[model samples]
Target: MFDLPPWQSWEMFGACFYAVRINALLVLGLSTVTLGELLPGTMMSVKTRSISVELLPSRVFRCTDTFGASSPQRISRQGNPLETIDWTSGDWIAVNDDNGVGVDIFFTLKEAATDNVVVFVDQRKRQFGKFQPCHAKDYIDKLSVCPDFLVARGARFVGGIMDCVSPSNLEKFVVPDDCFILSQAGTELFTALWRIIQRVRLSSPSTRHAKPPSRQCFKAVRKKWIKSLGKL
Candidate 1:
């Protein structure tokens, strides 16, 4: 017979030892396994059975006290200030103040529901390191009020923000308590946002200087994004 590889041999030995140990435990009444289910084959069969687990849905919150209200009151949760901005259908870009530090520009997509609002952060502002402690707190606090999840770039930057916050504050004010979920930015999301911006720029009748992309150029960009995603 052909010899098994060294790693494979060790794995087989480990499995056999585990089985024997389990069987011995069953015989000595040290395990919960029934007398009828003492065989290793029976144990394996039981383990292979499909298990059903129910996951609870995430809690959704209202963005403001009144629906379609232009100015919503700032709410407080666990001693942290939750800022609310006026609802906007177009891209809202905010510039840095005289201090050269300000909130990143965000695009308010739509009201997912009467009470829930979906907001998207500009992927260009992935520079988490550039944010000072006060800036980070301001950014995160604003995100806390969004009823729907916010999509942004830079998973590493998100992790860095989480690391900066204390564990108790993170759990109580940021994650489940605040009903916020941070999703890692994907190529598809970025491409979709880019396409929307391009469409808006070209479709604007007022912008006579804006040039639309050629069919070939559009195809090239699409292919490049597809290839990048495929590599990932």
Candidate 2:
């Protein structure tokens, strides 16, 4: 449920759980949202494009036979695709591989240059079988698709700025009322992402010089979504 083209697809909802990155940091989403507060230092680590993290309480568990994960807390354990379309391509991007790792763990390739902003979804060998280039409108009900994962207990979704990961210092990010791009952090994050997209399309992929957030440098960039300014 987390991956889809934000400009297109079911992901028109702005940001999502899958397909995330910011200043080179990967995103971690959770389906088990908590109404209560979690303690500090709680985290879940991922082995992806970057060694990303997801902060959460230990009440949740990973999606494996064992209750273990990188961090002490239980992992929700789960969780996108596309390329060469419009910036607002109303669809999410992903890559297909029959013998690949899986879309839930897929990341944008450094060399798979395309003329469009793309999200890479690695189709799992056992689940989706092989990946197909699709969009939000396609709305395939196949396993590991965005819609299904969003509703899945342990899976996380990926998409746009909404699909970014939180620093270890912050709590697990919960999507705000309108999504956070209007805030200072959101503005910087997406602006950088857009620049990266442009560079990639031009076949000159290089990230901005911004440093990752340190504990002292971190900022909670939450913002209220406003329907008047635009459509999600």
Candidate 3:
């Protein structure tokens, strides 16, 4: 006779617990790949009676078991996680000029084994104001504009804004030419928005220049935007 723990016994009763409901029905049948001989603790505890099961390529999915087996968890949210890509998307867009000199930003969910959602900014033309993906080098070669130079210029814009607005040095805020090289497409864009927020704070006489709350509604929103860029 196999004796089960309290939690196991309760879970085995039915799908009464939230974990049971989430894992068993959602993930479906799981197969054990490892073959382990019954050890001392194997039958002693329900948790020990488990074998490691891999759910294909590690896309995090929630798992539940009657015997309280460990399982991967899936994210359930209101909308598609990829759509919230503001910081990186905006950053790539900002680097490109309005005249279509640089790359155009676009993103789509690549439904591969692990759901490789990629955000890319490529320089290409499309019909009806659409963006098409092309090689970064192709865009640079066709436009006769050095990609390195563009990156440098964008970095300069970001550093200059930060220096100008920073409380420590407003006067000696020289925008570095190589700032863009140091800054990636996403980081530069995020910095730009942060500067904008600071600018708005400075301009408004009534509003005190207090640091943005670390844990607040706006910060939470910023986090979601950051997640799109895969920056956490």
Candidate 4:
């Protein structure tokens, strides 16, 4: 049986850089073309007897098992285990922002696979609009639904504040292997950060005349957004 992606998640963006890179390289090195046997693992579901976890092109959906137990062996009323979610669906995920607060939230699948759902959570503090990490002892309200999204069996009902998308936009949907969908807050946070970076690009002496920083720089920041990842 092939290995399914781990259930765990990264607590920081810096940590994910190397994680994604290493996984991507491993995925690249696999050379499925030369090793045809790997295809079956890619084609089959690990949930039914087993699953395969591909790190390369490390998109969430590509790395996770779409087929899972309709009814999990165990589910806690106050906790969630929807780890290794599908990035293709723009699912919310956990990440430690530069602010030292953990940003985690996402929407879940609705009734069926085709009829999926989109949700956005208010992870910020009710009074201040600051992020409220589930790890913090003070975030009692969010602690109950600690880890927000649930990849439930049968996809009966999803929980969270649903996001609305126009019908015209629905027709143009594709899950690129390079990008992962994030929660609304996450999307906003990333957008804000990118805007800041853009401003820096326009004003910074080193980048003013030069092209935007190299891709490696972004990857470098991800590896060490909080600290550093040793390998390239």
Candidate 5:
């Protein structure tokens, strides 16, 4: 009963066959797979009865059981309980430029159930972005002081108002250069962010790039952002 998605059916069968071939009778007997189905008229429900076994490529075995709960109960290869994560659709924030004109968007991919931020995404362009695994506080600090800190190592822009209109600013917004490689989950989150930004731009292009109402407004937003991230 190696239940898996339609796409992974072959992979699951392959793993099962390999296990049998390797004479892992104990593993094959202990392993069970349960496929979940949504019950009609329910908000969201999973009907699960037993434990599931996942065989890693290295042949390490892990078991997970949810028993209809939202969080899984995992057992490592050593038979010790493992931590669980419930990742949800994440949120985003928009940062204003130095002169308060133009905006750069950042996103936090988080696990809502565990209150963890897996990574921070900095959207440099429509097609390019970077994900930093640092703590939210550290990332925000670097972003506030120098938005280009990740891309530009030593270069620092001078002047106050002129900085907003600098060609470098435009260049940063448009240039699709080097980008960090993303895991499958990270790629999904990035695609979600792109869709959200596109919708925002379509609804109100000017508002998407508009300056903050006031410096106080910017501060208020930043404070709220930090407070929300503090829980992560």
Candidate 6:
């Protein structure tokens, strides 16, 4: 089977549960408020590029298994990829791999000299994939090809980010609404994280996560469907 690009393939939405500690720190003012929360009045004008990639069924399964599940009362077992992506790309100005190891994929715009952006996805080996509603439209004006689909033999949604020059005199450019920020904590966080980590660690490249509260297992040759933003 041919897998299209994940960006054009599915609309998967799941918050990274790992941000609980980071959120706690931010809430307590331990860390600098993410660039997204900077005072809007002092913001600057800088072109920003954001990419939202939906991991194929394989990648999503690995991630949820690594973090566990989401819960309100307890610290969420899930880790928020949004926050991680924002921190690596937005704050650090570099895409990061949050697999707790090293970054996997890296990308850069033609304008920038030094490639600072890095990207990662959580998934397993497959034929190919695709993505719809690509973010490339924001930057590119004239396009020879519309990124309605993405193709790859195997998809991996490990964590990563993109980096670029910090716009001067542009604090506004420094912050974005998309920055990862959410409040969650407690025993729930521990359970979720532990379970997820275990899931990813134990996952054989052939498995998938389809269970509930956070399914973390799947068959190698299966295609999963997720809700699209516009359709939902």
lDDT of each: 0.26, 0.24, 0.23, 0.26, 0.24, 0.22
C-alpha RMSD by candidate, in order: 25.9, 19.3, 26.5, 20.5, 25.4, 20.4
Candidate 5 residue runs with Cα over 4 Å from true position? 1-92, 98-103, 123-232
Better of 2 and 4 by lDDT: 4
Which 10-residue window of candidate 5 scores lowest in summed lDDT?
35-44
lDDT of 4 by residue, 79-174 (tens): 233533343242222222123222233223122224433221212222233222221223322221322233342222211211111111212233
Off by over 4 Å in 6: 1-13, 16-21, 30-118, 124-232
**TM-score of each prediction:** 0.21, 0.19, 0.18, 0.20, 0.17, 0.17
The order by descending TM-score is 1, 4, 2, 3, 6, 5
Q: Where does candidate 1 stray beyond 4 Å? A: 1-87, 92-102, 115-232
Q: Is candidate 1 or candidate 3 better by TM-score?
A: 1
- Report the lDDT of model 1 for residue 20: 35
* Candidate of highest TM-score: 1
Looking at model 5, residue 122 earns an lDDT score of 30
lDDT of 3 by residue, 99-139 (tens): 23333221111222333222222232222221112222232
Query: Which residue pairs in model 5 clash with each other?
Result: none
lDDT of 1 by residue, 1-232 (tens): 0154453333233223323333233222222222112111211122221111111111111122321112232321111226333323222211111122212222232221232223322111233343333543455554322222132211111111212112122222222121122122222332243343334335434322433435554454345334422321
lDDT of 6 at 57: 22
Lowest summed lDDT window (length 10), candidate 3? 34-43
* C-alpha positional error of residue 45 in candidate 4 after TM-score superposition, expressed in Å: 20
lDDT (tens digit, per residue) of candidate 6 on 26-93? 22222222121221111212322222221222112112111211101111112343322212222111
Candidate 3 colliding pairs? 23-64, 61-72, 62-74, 155-180
Query: What's the distance in Å from true for residue 191, model 3?
Result: 6.6
Q: Evaluate residue 17 in candidate 2 and report its C-alpha lDDT on the 0 to 100 scale.
A: 24
